[model samples]
Target chain A: MSALLQVRGLSRHYGQRIGCEDVSFDLHPGELLCVVGESGSGKSTLLSTVAAQLAPSAGTVRYRQRDGEWLELGTLSEADRRRLAREEWGFVTQNPRDGLRLNVSAGANVAERLMALGMRNYSQLRGIARSWLERVEIDAARIDDAPTSFSGGMQQRLQIARTLVTQPRLVFMDEPTAGLDVSVQARILDLLRGLVNELGLAAVMVTHDLAVARLLAARTIVMQGGRVVETGLTDQILDDPQHPYTQLLVSSVLTT
Target chain B: MTPSYNFAFLDEDTKRMLRRALLKAVAIPGYQVPFGSREMPLPYGWGTGGIQVTAALLGRDDILKVIDQGADDTTNAVNIRRFFARVAGVETTEHTVDASLIQTRHRIPETPLREDQILVFQVPEPEPLRTLEPREAETRTLHALADYGLMHVKLYEDIAQYGHIATSYDYPVLVDDRFLTSPSPIPKFDNPKLDRSPALMLFGAGREKRLYAIPPYTKVESLAFDDHPFEIQRWEHRCELCGSAESYLDEVIVDDRGSRMFVCSDTDFCGDRRAEAQA
Candidate 1:
C-alpha cells in the first residue's frame, strides 16, 4: 500500500539549538504512529513541523491529497495551508481548553469545522454534532452546556468529538491523555482506538507514556535528544528494544 | 463663506487623503480599509466617523441630513447637523427625500434612499469578528482567508441558547459574497434595504480608523443557517401617533406609572405622514 504522508530529513532548529533533527517517516492510511520520548526530546517539535504549525529549517513533508496528488506542505500558501488544516486535517492539543472553544456550547464546538466548510443548515449541524457527541461518549442532553462546566475528562472527550466531527483524514494529537487520571486515560484510549479503527484515520501522536503507545499505536518511534533512537512495531520495541534509550524507556514502565 | 478653515473643516490635503481611502473602500465592497482618522471637534463616540465621511463628501450644493436612531432632532443628530452647517455652509434638511447626503447612527431611514443620495454610517466598532476573535492580526488573516466559521459559531450559540439567532443589531453580513462586513449596528430590520440598493453606502469608524463601503446594487447577505434563517425584529404595536404599521417604533413612557405608547422611531417619516394626511 502507498503511504499517505512522507517526511524526508525533516529538521527544525531554534537558531543554534536543534529542535528535531533528521526525522523521517512514512505514514500510511489507517496507520497510527506514536512518537515516544522524554521531555525536550523534540517529539512536540517534530509533530508541529509535520503538522505545518512550525516551519522546518530543513527537509520536505509531502502529503497525498484525497484526489491522489502529492502536495509539498512547505510550498503551499498560507491560505492553502490554513484551508487544509481546517478541511482535511485536525489537531488535538494536550489541553482540552486549548482545543475547545470554552465560551461556546458543546454542540457549537463540535460543529465549528463543518460550518467553516460551508455547512449552513443549523439543524443538520446540530444533528451531526449530536451523533458525534454520542460517539465520543458525551451525553447528547449536555449539548448546550459550556466546556467550562465540563470535568477535565469530559472536556477532553468533547475535544476529541470536535476534532473528529469533520471526519478528517489525518489527526495530530499532542499528549491527549497526559493530564487525565489513570482510569479516565484508559477510557479515552479505548474510545480513540475504536474511533481510529472505525474511521480509518491516520494519526501521529506524541506521548511520553509507553503504555499508551502499547494501547493505541501500531508502530513506535523512540526519540532521545532530538533524534530517533529506535523505530519498530510497538510490541517489538517494548518487548526487545535495540537502542539503549529505547531499552531504558521500556524498562522504566512499572508493571504492577 | 468664512475661509478660516478649509472646506468642511478638514484641510484640502486631509480631505484628499480621506477621499483616497473612501475610493478604495468603495472599490472593494465591504472590505475595511484602514485610513488616517482625524480628531473631530466632537468626542469619539458622538458620530465622529460619520461626520468625517460627510465632511469629505459634502459639496456646496449638497443638502445634508443627520439622524440618531432614526430621529432627526435628537441631541446627536442636531449637533452633527449644526456642525456641518457651520463648517461646510451646506443646505441642511430634515426630510429624507430632500437630503443628498445622510449621515446616520444606529438606524437606516424609513424612506427609501434614491440613486442620487449617499448614506454614511457612523460605526463604533468596525470589525465583525472583533467580539469573536480579539486579536487584530488574527482577524486580518481570517478576513484574508474568508474564514468566518467564528461568526457561524456565534450564531449557533445564539440558536442553542435562545432557540433562534438572537442578535438584533450589528448583525454580520457577507458583502458582495466576499468580505464579512458589519452593517454598522443597524437593526436587522433594515438589512434588506442594504441589498441591491440604488444608493451607495459608506461606513466609517473614527475610533477604529477604518472605512468600508457597499456600492450600488451590491449583495449584503446577513449570516444565517437554512434552518434558522436570518430574521428581523417584529413589532406588535403600530405607531400610535402616525398610525403607520410599517415603520420602526420606539416605546415612549407616558407617565411614572409605566404607561407607554409606541411611536415611529423616524421622526421625519412620521411628520411627513401626518402632513400628508392633513393635506
Candidate 2:
C-alpha cells in the first residue's frame, strides 16, 4: 500500500546545462515505471540521479529500507551508499559486458552479489547460481564458461540473472535491450517481463523505444528536452495522447 | 659504522621518516601506509624495499639475518647481509633463531619465530587487487568498502578451470579481518604460520612506495571457499639429506638419467637437522 521509492522534484544539472529538471514520481511495490524519450531527452539522467549514481542538483530521493525505515539517499555516507547498491539494489546496464565481469565465469557473475553480502558456502552459492541460470534460460551446463563466450542475447540474460539472483526489491535498467537484433530484443523483453512479474519487482527502466515501454511498464512518463511532456497509464498514453509530444511519439512508432 | 656512510646506509632524516611510516603501518595492522621510497644501491626488484626496512630498524646491537628463497647462501641473501655488515657494521648471522632481525624474500623460515624477532618481507606489488582490477582508484574504493567479491571470482575461476585454487605463492590473505593483503609470494604452506604468530611481520614495497605491518598474534586468513577450502603444497618424499618429512621440499635434479631428489627448501633447517643426526 505504501510507496517503495519517493522522488520529489528531482533535478540534475551539468554546470549550466540541464540534464533533467523538475521530475517527481512515486514507485510502489510490484510496480514498473518506464521513462521513454528520444536520445538526450534526460531519460538516463533521471534514472542515474534517482539511482544515486549521480548527484542531484535539487530535491530529495528517498527509499524505504527492508527494516521499514526511510533512508534519504543524499544524506547517506559513501560506505552505506555502496552497501545499499550492492545488497538491496541492482542496476542492469545496456551492455551486458559492462554489467557482467568478463574475466569471471557465468556462475561467479551470478554469485557475486551473494558473495559480496558474506555468503561463504561455495556449494550453496553455486547451486543458487545454477538454478538462476536455468531460470533465465541459460544452459546450466555453461555455468563455468566465460560470459564473453556467450552470444549477445545469452549475455544479456546472464546479466539479468546476475542482477536478480540476490532478489533485489528494486532494479534500475538503462536501455537494456538496446543494440540487440530485433528478434533477440523481443526475446529479452519477454524474458524481462516474465521475471519482473514473477518476482514482484519494482523497476524503473529508461528506454527510447515506446513499444518497449508498452510491453514492460505499467505506468509511462514521456519526456521531451529534459522535461516530462505527458505521463499516464501505458495503454491510455499509447491510445489517447494529451500532449503534442505524446501524440507525435505515438504517431512516429510503426503500429501494426 | 663506515666512515663514508651513515648508519644503515640511510641518512638520519630518511630513517626518521621511515620510522614514522613504520609506526603508522604497525598501528593500523594491515593498512598500507605510503612513504617516500629512496633509491638504494641495489636494483629495484632485488629486495630494495626489504633493505630500506632493514636499514630503518637496524640497531647497533641487533643481529641481522637475510635469506632469499629460504637459502642463506644465495646471491641476494649473501649480498644483502654483506651490505648491512659493511654499512652498519652490525652482527650478521645465518641462523634464524639467533638473529634478532630477519629480512627475507619469497619464503618464511621453517623454524617458528619468537616474540622478540621481527620478519621483513620484500614486496614487488603491494595491492592484492592489482591484477583483477587495473584501476588504482577503483581498487582503493573496493578496499574502503570491504567489497572483495572480485577476489572470490578469481578463486571461482580457478576452481572452474583446475578443480581447485591453483594459486601457490603470493596467495591473497585477509589481514586482521579487514584488509585483503598480499602475503609477499610466500607459499600457501606458510600462510598458516602467519596466523597468531609470535613474531611481528612487516611488508615493504619500494617500487610501489607502500608499507604495511602485522603485529604479533593477529588473524591472517587465506581466501578460500567453504567447499573448496585452502590447501598447501605437499610432497611424497622427505628431505634427502636431513630425512625430515615435515618441511617444504624442492625437487632437485640428481643426474643426467632424469633421477630427482627432494630437499628441504630451508637450508638452515636442513643443516641443523643433519647436525643433530651427527651429534
Model 2's TM-score against the true structure: 0.98
Position A198, candidate 2: lDDT: 95
Instruction: Please provide, for model 1 over A16-112, each residue's C-alpha lDDT reduced to its tens digit, 9 standing for 90 to 100.
Output: 9999999999999999999999999999999999999999999999999899899999999999899889988999999999998888899999999
Q: List candidate 1 segments past 4 Å from native.
A: B1-3
User: Poorest 10 consecutive residues of model 2 chain B by lDDT?
Assistant: B152-161
* lDDT for model 2: 0.93
Give every collision pair in model 1.
Answer: none
Residue B13 displacement (Å), model 2:
1.2
Report per-candidate DockQ. Answer: 0.88, 0.69
Report how far off residue B19 is in candidate 1 (Å): 0.4
| Model 1 chain A weakest lDDT span, ten residues long | A244-253
